[model samples]
Target: MESYGFIDCKDPKYVDTVKAIERELLFDGLLFRYKNNDDFGEPKSSFTVCTFWYINSLFKIGEETKAKNLFDQLLSNSNHMGLFSEDLDFKTKKC
Candidate 1:
């Protein structure tokens, strides 16, 4: 895909940029869309849709193994009925 209008994953600059962006968005290997607190100073948890997008990006960027692992973890976080919540409490491990 790099030859098809995609970023060159093997290029050093692109690789470094990808790593930097990943670091900024991920905490303890979990992805978050944002971390800023509201006016009440209560921060929002990781967004589940953002997490799914992150997993997809990982596969697109050639991190297949890690992406699969993260995808499995994300699935495990779903409710018993196979339902997913929008946000999660990372500390409490609650949805």
Candidate 2:
């Protein structure tokens, strides 16, 4: 997919940005939108769309194998009907 911006995917900054996101946002095989306390206090669930976008970014940055593995892991956590909610509990994997 096109980056939709001037920054090339191969650029060190872009790669490093993605790496930083993974380092700070990824948790328990899922991806949290952000860290730190918010109005609701610290986040307790993974933001589904943020995780998907991160997985896509991983693929765009040449981490296809890792992205695929994460994709599968996330998919496996979906409900039996193959549906996902906006948020998923970190421990229970429930919506």
Candidate 3:
């Protein structure tokens, strides 16, 4: 959406995409990159970048309050150095 400049526009497709992402990837307010099992095993963590994208998507879709709340929650899960890893544990939120 950002690459195509669709983030600033209130497009129904963007809204639908956000809704679909929320329904399929969102877990406990965090966003997972995928649900399928890879060669290693089923994914057990949420991708930090994907969650960040979700935050932006929420704000772009007129869900500012939700976006802000989720942003704060994400921040709170960060490490003592105020850094997030590529992935966060889904249940415990450990990096």
Residue 66 lDDT, candidate 1, scale 0-100: 91
Candidate 3 similarity to native, TM-score: 0.92
Candidate 1 structure, TM-score to reference? 0.73
Error of 2 at 2 (Å): 5.4
Cα lDDT tens digits, model 1, 1-95, are: 44465666667766566577578877655667666767757455777787787777678678999999988987887888988888776765458
The candidate with the higher lDDT, 1 or 3, is 3
Ten contiguous residues minimizing lDDT sum, candidate 3:
1-10
Global lDDT scores for all candidate models: 0.72, 0.90, 0.90
- Candidate 2 deviant stretches above 4 angstroms: none
lDDT, candidate 3, equals 0.90
Q: Pick by TM-score: which candidate is best? A: 3
Q: Rank the models by TM-score, top first.
A: 3, 2, 1
Clashing pairs in 2: none
What's the CA error at residue 52 for candidate 3, in Å? 0.5
User: Which ten-residue region of model 1 has the weakest summed lDDT?
Assistant: 1-10
